[model samples]
Target chain A: MSKVNIALDIMGGDLGPHVLLDAAKKSLEHYSDLHITLCGHSSVYQSFINTLSGDLKARITLEECDEVVSMSDKPTTALRQKKQSSMRRAIDLVEQRKADACVSSGNTGALMAMAYYVLKTLPGISRPALISWLPKAQGKKVLLLDLGASVNCDAEGLFQYAVMGSVFAKLCAGVESPKVALLNVGEEDIKGNTLVKHADQLLRDSQSVDYIGYVEGDQIFAGKADVVVTDGFTGNIALKSSEGIAKLVIDELKRLTTENFTARLLSKLALPFLKKLYQRMNPDQYNGASLIGLRGIVVKSHGNANSEASFYAIKQAYEEAKNAVPDKIKTKIESVLMEH
Target chain B: MSKVNIALDIMGGDLGPHVLLDAAKKSLEHYSDLHITLCGHSSVYQSFINTLSGDLKARITLEECDEVVSMSDKPTTALRQKKQSSMRRAIDLVEQRKADACVSSGNTGALMAMAYYVLKTLPGISRPALISWLPKAQGKKVLLLDLGASVNCDAEGLFQYAVMGSVFAKLCAGVESPKVALLNVGEEDIKGNTLVKHADQLLRDSQSVDYIGYVEGDQIFAGKADVVVTDGFTGNIALKSSEGIAKLVIDELKRLTTENFTARLLSKLALPFLKKLYQRMNPDQYNGASLIGLRGIVVKSHGNANSEASFYAIKQAYEEAKNAVPDKIKTKIESVLMEH
Candidate 1:
């Protein structure tokens, strides 16, 4: 039987390996063929293993690496110097085909740098983009691109992003046309700056991708389009700001409920429905992002991710591997580039 | 009292003569020595005048303008063809020295174009920018510039924006030695693109303006700085997105609180506090933004404004006319340019 070996940098993530260890144990019990090669500090992983249930202990492989990459460390230098780090070792497993894919909730910049320098970009791909999903109004999700991968992007970069994001929406969210929108200052085709204007013209002209015209920042939450493309700078702002706004809104509700006795009664009555809605938009639930257009499948989870988030990152890797996202992105990008 | 004659575009705004009349009534009540020339359709102004209450009946003059510029009309053509439109007529009042400034809630583009065509930019001012106060924590506000005036801008323009915003914040918000920061992807001086990078260096090197280095988007609401500088595109997104997010957050709070019994109790307790916050951040409180660096004061009121908003716009005009924002901006920009 062909097996999918998944490598995880368990020593990463803000909550240490406990959250990941718990999730990995559960994940192992759920999937018989799932093999987790946890590359991390040996002592930490061993201590975790003795505490885990028998099933989890049987399915896990502890790979030791003394070095660790801090979140704020410079990506380029860390990639070159941290050759023996758990992050690099995990990517090395993917490079050697020991693992079908890799997952990390560590430093995004470091992970992206290591993935590019080691695993390398897919054939004919100019750049890789980070893509995340959020459940919209109708229980369907929208794929938002370049969440933090490339800080500086141009017309061509956005073009590539649109195609990758569209594919992710179709394969993952089941959107057929996957109505794509290029996030901009306004909805008008000519309303934005040179980068946006050029991207609009190019997207309209492209045959492979469905290029919906410009969409504003507010429209992002409404899930106006199945796929939204933007420069990393703006995309990152839109993502974090949306999450911040959601949290702020939730906090306000809690504040109102707890303010007085009568309001607390109201809050009690409204708790169930509100909980459902909160569950719907919670960032922890939608924690994983596929680093598409790379040679191997790479999932960049939230930096502050606990075990639950990192587990979602692993599941995201599992599903993304099934879809063959890297090869798909390469094919789509190459075809578009050739035609253009 | 020194009389400051101002032009009132009675035919402007979403709600025309009614709002204008009401605003003029309130405006005259405060500044008794202030004179207003109401320029609009003869019949419209006359109808309002016939119904005018209190002493304001004698405080306003009916200057009939045969043509009126709609919100959708192109400002350049409106100025050229609508020889007697209320907007054109208002700018004409400023040019003729019949009024110190003009206030309108008409087409933003048309108003901007007409002002530039008629009043022209102040010497050493390459472009005029619109500044708005973004609500931050602690009931404090930061001056955000060129919200939608210019689509694309260079480093020099933003450098000038810093100077203009600094002077405006000091005069308006009463912030002494207001901390100014460049809005960019990262707070580091080395962050952002060439436009921001060079601007950062210039701002750092500049002795005239208070340069507080680079500030990230998330930091905008943290009340970290008194003034934030950004290009029109990003500035427009930041401003509008904040408004949209604020509305969404408030709306979600209402939705969650009214969901059930618990929510009802929560809402009952929280509504008062929430309403106070909503009121504090309401755009109506600050309805006027001086078209900084113009030869004459030009205040752009909210397009969806009502009587109360119009009254606030009038109040802003009184302040600008009193503060001489146009003259202040002129001296500030010229000094910076001369130094450059």
Candidate 2:
């Protein structure tokens, strides 16, 4: 891969710019050909720059921005008012081709709005979806899209998402002609609302997508399909619900294993395995949700993301940049739409 | 508690009528004051009747129905064509006042349609919702409604759900002035789609409900509110997604524990704790989801329910019947709406 550059929105995320700065440093060390342009308050970068070696310092660039898009900021306000914000600056870097991708752990809606305003959608795509990889059976991952980018999606919007997700699964997840499915309440032909049912038909008729019918929420991790597409509302709730349950289970396990001396001793042996399981299942570990169907690559990390999670987001941006995800999606969508 | 009479749809569920019959027997054994009216193919009951003691036999009544509502049957077809079906007959028993509640593991849509047609909605309620209990932190459970009964709910519909859920939480879940919340992508006032925002305003304006603002999917199990209300699509997907992740975690743990002899031996001590955790978290074990906003109580079990799960459904029906949940909801909705 050629030099993959990611513009990091350091002022964004709950842990603040310091954590993101640490992640940026870690990411540079991990990816040999990766370059990071830190966009945030200049003072945080100043103190951190002293620790980096000459080789590392030479690769990193600081693009100082005065404003920060807080987690509570409305998307419209962030888009119209926060032009000089760190999140906007990061996306600006991507648009200017100074960075191949933009990574932010800021407000999702604001990031999305700014990205849409700055990067614009790819040709043949109506909207850009927040696509993320979810763990499936056999150590495989499935691509779930529109995780909160576009809430009230019409049938055509959902159909576009299907094509985009299929393209993403193939290009980014390394699946060939990825089997795509619509997320509905039931797998039956007569299931779901009008939007999903219509989208299902559109997907079934498409020659470009390997449409595999519907999969309910419980079947999401059953390795039923390579990509699952749904409107942002359902997708966001489903994703968060999965995270909630995973956390609940982990908490319950922790409580159970320490309830008694016998349990504690037994759990000591299983601790390593438990840690590995946590790492695999934790949503924080799966750090980035890339805004696909756009002219430029933009990865949105979780708002509450720590340094580790932020590093994973940078890593995600590096991979997507290397894969040229947006270009592939644009190509795939154009070919798929032309068939109709 | 008085003798709680429950009409059982024996011919429904994946395990066939035999599993329901087993559940009926178990329910009768567990709840001494409970009487069951079995509505299904009489041949299944006739053969088993010989083994029952006179005391148990006297408490049971068989209401023979020729037709069965299959899981795949459309709601309209089940309502129009299958009047003589087991599910319909069970619901009819409730309508006729022969049974206090009806229990079914049949098609949810079919059950909802038949129940709505036969029993009708409460005085101020427009649509019925499938309300189920979800485990929260500290051994508590939160009430999640509209699991798949009503899709495409408007602001008024969602607001009504909030009111109904609040009533249910107070009466059934034993919460005083239950805190109600609308489930959305984010907790912010600016978050969520148009329906939720409108509903939030309505809920806030209402004096009857203890409206606690919006909650995200991850907070559903965090005990943030006593009741969580959402449209059927989001609620169903969120629920099934939670189930999927929980199952995945369990499956992963099983694989990890059995990977080596040391791990296997260690897990043996933690086996009981794990089993308890599974029981608490498993969706199958939380068998019944009651249809609220109706004139009568109708508990819908999982279609693929085992005898154990089916028994829990029967137990759920018995409790609802004893509590006169329908009457309570009717009074609550009428009183709450009258304030407007």
Candidate 3:
């Protein structure tokens, strides 16, 4: 409830800096104790700053950067070359202790690389992972991790992810002794690739994790586990595939509603309920994917995020900052290592 | 059209033998020229056969087996022991040329193992792949391969899947020159693990395939590519995740409609269109997933398939048999190898 300083890459995302600036303005209005450090070009910030008033003006600061990380820029290129980039500057703010957390809707790989280079991983953690929550039935949420940060994970990496994810679910979702499960093709111990099979054994042997058995993709939203862990490659595909199917269903529903008079009338009558359903199932609501296991908190928003989604990402950073997620995760991981 | 023969495993699937029997009866009723070789306990077949008359009785033949391949049975167990299992016997019917193709709704792993052991791979194909078509928008379907057949696929395995999938799209889906793509986390050449990157280069250099660039999970149903290829781990997760989301959407819709009286009446008005949409997007309609790159045709139905879904699996077997799919795939792979 004290002032939470959050840094955001204003020049990031598919839309121009104005979208991020608008989100920053909205966040400033919504959260009275929130302070924002906007990292982007000075001209964009100057024009926006001229319109702000006393308290609002005092809460906002700018770190002018000369370069922008484009969506197509490779991770290696972004890290080695774009040192003065907005994305890098935002992460740099977090590392310099000027911001409690940093958020970006820029290129995911670039943001991840920059965060890894600047913020670094915590002790007892080998790598940072991309973790995000998705809506489950009955208004609950399931946290899925390693969305795309580290592909080709070993048993050790997967075991570490399990530990990190369990901590995240407990802290963020408030699940006491969060049930963690490994994502595989089938729930059986015999299913999936060798990596998962080995990871399964490691998870089962670990006393620190409240490790449940394996869960398949179909069980991800069935509320079987508080946290579902997988390698980045499989996790990314599963997440994106769900999004694709959701879009397909929505498009089909849209087409049906406009097809005939009866459907049109039905759609009109059912508009409120439909909107509620859409809101419940909307991907935009689950916008921020935080890079956990780092020394500093970093939330990566979706690349194609709209203003609302960008605001949600900022909210995520604020919450993570308030809770000091990275510190908590570090403590939890150390305890888990002690258990070993 | 000549008489197409398909062997059905009477004792498979989550449902009992009666479901497969009902499907067999339905297939016989629909296709007058179709002959079915039923593999299961003779007592079950005898009771069913008593009701039939004339050509219907003569068209159906029984291959009695004492054993059954349970869903819990390991692939190795089914392959080594249980040679006379209903599932194995059904496959044997195809191998013996008594039936053109066979259908089983048994354990996928067991079915794959049995089919590979009995029928063996085609001359140039290293391994078999599980492939099925998903409904795309505008009444098209996209073919996805290695659904759970080969978990750890190398670049050569992927390149072979592309060749087989391309041939499948052409022969089964009736596309002239199907556009084939490798599934990845991103669409760029620089994205994904090393396996896909190597496969991309191999696919690009191949003359046999009409290779499109990489596609992300969201593009699976965008109708952008005719065939999508990935290792079994990612493919299985992506496929099941899409199914999970589809089920989630449907359940949410049902909950919304039944929430209030107005919503109920609106649902009634939209009932016809909803039914049509459900039918079009139904997973049951796309039930059978054939194990390609084998010497003979074998269709693996979902374990939890209903009567309609089981019938669709049998139908898939009939079509694959009619098309001589294995022979076509063999020919295609040989040409691709010859080109190299």
Per DockQ, the best of the predicted structures is 2
lDDT (Cα, tens digit) per residue for candidate 3, span B1-340 = 3999898998888888888888998999988889999999998788888888777888998887999988888899889898989999988888898889999988888999889999999998888999999978766789999898988889999999999999888887799999999999998777889899999999888888899989989889884899999999899999998988888887888788887888888778767877877887899989999999999999999888999999999888888888889888988888888999
Candidate 1 ranges beyond 4 A from true positions = A1-4, A26-33, A134-141, A241-281, B15-17, B30-33, B261-274, B338-340
Model 1 share of native interface contacts: 0.21
Q: At residue A184, give the lDDT of candidate 1.
A: 79
Give model 3 RMSD, 1 decimal: 1.5
Interface RMSD of 1: 3.5
- Judge candidate 1 at residue B326 and give its lDDT: 76
Q: Number of clashes in model 1?
A: 20
lDDT of 3: 0.89
List, residue by residue over B182-201, the lDDT tens digit for candidate 2.
99988888888888899999
lDDT of 1 at B35: 87
> Can you write out model 3's per-residue Cα lDDT over A1-340, one digit (the tens) per residue?
4789999998888878888888899999999999999998998899899888888999998898999999899999999999999999989989999899999999998999889989889998888899998888777789998998987789999999999998888777778899999988888878888999999999888788899989888889885798999999999999988988888887888788888887887778768977988988987789999999899999998878888888999998888888778888888888888888
Interface alpha-carbon RMSD, every candidate = 3.5, 1.0, 1.0
RMSD of 1: 3.2
| Winner by lDDT | 3
Instruction: Quote model 1's TM-score.
Output: 0.90
Model 3 misplacement above 4 A: none
Worst 10 residues of 2 chain B by lDDT: B278-287
lDDT of 1 by residue, A178-203 (tens): 88998877675447889988888888
lDDT of 2 by residue, A238-289 (tens): 9988888888899999888888897887678778988978877767667899
DockQ of each: 0.34, 0.80, 0.78
